[model samples]
Target: MTTTTATAEATTATDVLIVGAGPTGLTLACTLARAGAAVRIIDKSPEPHRASRGKGLNQRSRELFDDLGAGAEAAAWGTERVTLRKYRDGVAIADTVAFGDRTPTPDTPYASGLLIPQWRTEEVLRRTLARYGVEPEFGRELTGFTQGADGVVATLADGRRIKAAYLVGCDGGRSPVRKALDVTFEGRTDTEECMVIGDVRVDGLDPAYWHQWFDEDAAVMLCPFRGSTHWQLQGMPERDADGRALPPSLESFQRLVDRCSRRTDIRLSDPTWFSVYRINVRMADRFRTGRVLLAGDAAHVHSIAGGLGMNTGIQDAFNLGWKLAYVVRGLASPGLLDTYEEERLPVAAWTLGLTEERLRAVTEGVKQAGVGTEAVVTDDVTTLGVGYSWSSLAWGGAKAGERAPDGPCGDGRLFDVFAGPHFTLLGFGRGSAQALAEAGEKCADRLRTCLVDDPTGHARRAYGIGEGEDALVLVRPDNHIALSAGADRGAEIADRLLRLGR
Candidate 1:
């Protein structure tokens, strides 16, 4: 049912084909390939560019990378910010708040945001892929595609073709693959303010703390970057008597900074790169069409209010990776695909609402002419708060338990189950070991089972796992619990895993 055109010279067939080589695409390719998938990634660009955008990686994204065996590289590239300070009209308002401590999560490791440019992140992921002997197929582009029940026939712009079982569109806002799927990206664009984003070396700004400056006229934000002396400055350019957009120039930017900071003597230099973009909160009505799907910007686009854009995309890949691997390995049913939208769609909507609320608060604060200090930047409302309610794969109700929370468990040392690639069974009483041992055998080729033993039992109370409880929990490989049947229902856990995809 699939055919390759003469142009796809790299291979006759690929298990998974990904369009676009941005962070989201590359991350999905990496996840799929690492699990023994034959993944091929193509981008129109011949090489990666030097433009530095999205200066901060939220807590959820950092944790995902750590799980994929690249945490050290991420740490080497980013500096941690311990304190967050708020400013008002060139004067101090509320003191700095300590919000940088990493916390426990259901599946991931990183608990705080790390300062790093978008390019640096791609570099690490590229290297990680190279280690596995899979180089990205750059300079190639997808022109058209036809889908069938078995696979898809994708044509290349240069007359080449490839047959793939599945395809993920990680391309940016203007995604060709998403267009081919005929999905509607529903949302509106806000032109009130276009952000001028850039990274540079500043002569005298402390990197340990994040600083914000707010004034009646304009605002200035300076945050720490991975490299020494380099800082990301997002400045609102000054306008004339007319309300026309100001041409963002060096002197104009400096004057705005000086007027807000009251530091006219401070000199600035070395402009790396700058761009103006109006943030649009948009998304596809459906995440997947047949075997072709979307993630990251291809699926959702929103403001930088929570620094959660890229992080949400990365987590989306994480959420899909394990499921795809299991289904590809013939261990789960195809029914798993529906859960992707049911779980992630609502999360994206919540994030859009939260970011809009944050933007509104900042706009109101600007009208009042005070620094929008309390409007904390985050994309977590979309990234971390994601949970599945309508998933046929997940057991629903209080019997469904509290959608599984992340906290300190086991012996004294804190641990998260996802430190390894496996499904975890959390129990408060006896009979859990037996339940998992049985599920492990039934889905031995698909799910790896682990029992999180917490003698202290605080974890049980926190997750509503009652003491002397007689229930057996079934967590997916991605760390989301699929079922929480009582101890008498251990056999049902394995049954659910086997019958889930059908």
Candidate 2:
């Protein structure tokens, strides 16, 4: 490949060139680096983001972080069991638990979400990425790119060129890569509906609950950031006489809070970050065009009603990481990369619809029933139940394409065995040991084989294997079951493995 810019100083090469250093891009970089892919990640911003943009991690995303070796650190900085305190006319009306009700089961270890700042989550990811000897190159912006049959050549703002086998756009909603591809972003932006959001320090306010005050026309919410004195503030944007929304400022935030809560004891100051948030429900027409792909907000965006924005992006990186790594490593054909969009596109569509519904519920519920935004919260928001059974890779029964459940195996849990940059094969009974051994010997570098010896039968039950029945399960690197079959079908198992790029 050749660059169009003659002034391009030098050409650097890598297996993958990722644009954007946000949570999604950082997660992808960590995954690819751990999988031994030569990755180069860059961001236009000179420094890491300091704002707490998306302030929560769902159960599914927590699992992804755990696999990346950053889960414990993220959890340490997060707060669980936070109470939602509602107020009306400065009087406390109701108090409800947000994520404290869920209990962890053997099959689902992370049943609850964590409340952590977005900047903190990015920090954890960056720390993990450093372990793999890769760091995002900040202030290196992608000015343009050209892709040929073999690879892509990206031109940066500094007149440098990066040649890579693949390019992924993890940039936010206004993605330059997506625009360069001429891809259509299909959906609408609700400019009329806007909110002023920021992180601020408050004095004389208790941090025990996520305080929310609601009146007939407006509302203000202050959620304390876990492990920090700062809190995230969200309220209606102040509008001028002509109905134009004013720019967000510390004074305007204070006025909104005082008017909504009717409280004089609270004081707000030291605004670290602030922005005007508008709902944009949109998704790219396609996730891929030749050697370039899109992930995270570059692919889809929705309302922040259910806090699914960042979690969905994290999950997107998890799903694409393994497939992209395999293709780069020559373990799979380029066609394997197509499955990334096939599997995740539907998920993005579902999330857009779900969040839009929740946004409507919050708006209408507040006016009709005096309900808070917490009314939008549901078990579905956890994303634990999301599956891709309809994908072409999913084969044989309901368990296929579903997330591999965690259960007790030997001394540790199933996740302990599944955590890594390799696929997993679980032989449920002695009858399947031979097949497991053969598959392991053939694909030793890319697959991990386990013979479950769970006396409590919890693992078998979670996997949908009947008591005393023999079965073989093949799980993808991302921990989704690719296929399952009877133990006796050893030849079929081998055939499927070979077809899956073993």
Candidate 3:
């Protein structure tokens, strides 16, 4: 795909202007660029973040990265299925395997989450974005913005101006774009609960396990990052006399480790990053206002118990990228963009509730039996079960609005056909030839049709189609099933695509 960036004197024009070049913004930029949309991504930070913030990726996020062409590099730099080792009073207690007894299947290839530092994940995304001839403009910050009927005009901190058909905030929780829109972030912050988190180099510890030490009053976890010497530390913070958490430092972290493990032999030094983490569960009332929109942390933030923060944001970008591209290219009506919020907002709500429950369970389990951090790991956190069944675009079958399952397709797999920025029409069995031909006739430019050869019956079983039956399944660019129907409904499928474009 070919893309172009426009600039006129002091003002820059783009199809989408993304603020905050973190994983969310970078992912969005990459997605749009791949779809031939002119995009510009800017961040206030002078450079990429060095700290390991969100330290893992769920299975769904792994799939998104795979689709973006960064999966191989990420897997090379990441460690999967690290064992969780628990300790009590400096003595070993229990050892639990991550994603116990789960392995990759035909329909779901990514069976386990990956342990890679947040910085590494961002690095992978940045590299992918660079492949599209786009690089993030660091130190460029959005000061304010105003939207008109056609586009948004954004002012920067440096007095530069940007005009874009759409502006998305992939910014952090304290997003200026969302605030300028005056959207309410409805949730509570837990001031009483806090944890000190950072990346540090530690000696006298095995790099094999995610080490966790638990006691009655406090707990600490040190997870060794893959392909690095640094370990991400999370522990109960020391409080002052007024019951306020003190500032985090190297010495404070050492004390925390010693007190939590009841061991003085473990040595810690060279702290690269440190901060106090508070429980803040908040979601923006509206993900979009006029031409401005929000994704990632700007849209919703919840507990990090399930490591859903970064993954959710990456998925949000994937969901919005194709819709934005379609509208900008005039191939789809502007109303198509409304479905982004419609589909993602409910997922955000579900994520908040699920993570909150997990956090509460971990807290109570720690008090009862000194449960390890592995207690938080469940199949739900993998995010493979998450779907948009309630979405307006979902229709005709049980699989609609759900993720398109991967399966055998002749020499390769189903994902190989869904790898690009185009919709896929899967015609199951010979009877679907008419439906495939009709859909191809109407949406040939934006759609790819495949007559699935299911000799092993894996594809049929995964998609809920009978062995000898035929069906037509339309999959969105983001790999979500849009609609499913019998093979005879060829014209109906074509009509749906035409209506969407209109």
Candidate 2 wrong stretches, greater than 4 Å: 1-12, 368-370
Candidate 2 residues 233-341, lDDT tens each?
Answer: 9999899999999999999999998898787879999999999999899999999999899999999999998999999999999999988898888777788888899
Clashes of each: 12, 0, 0
- After TM-score superposition, the amount by which residue 225's alpha carbon in candidate 3 deviates from its true location, in angstroms, is 0.9
Q: Specify the poorest-scoring 10-residue window by lDDT in model 1.
A: 1-10
Checking candidate 3 for backbone clashes, the offending pairs are none
lDDT of 1 at 304: 77
- Candidate 3: tens digits of C-alpha lDDT, residues 169-236: 99999988888888899999998989999999999889998899888777889999877888999998
Let me know the TM-score candidate 3 reaches against the reference structure.
Answer: 0.96
Which regions of candidate 3 are displaced past 4 Å? 1-12
Point out the higher-scoring one by TM-score: 1 or 3: 3
User: Which candidate model has the greater lDDT, 1 or 2?
Assistant: 2
Instruction: Give candidate 1's whole-model lDDT.
Output: 0.69
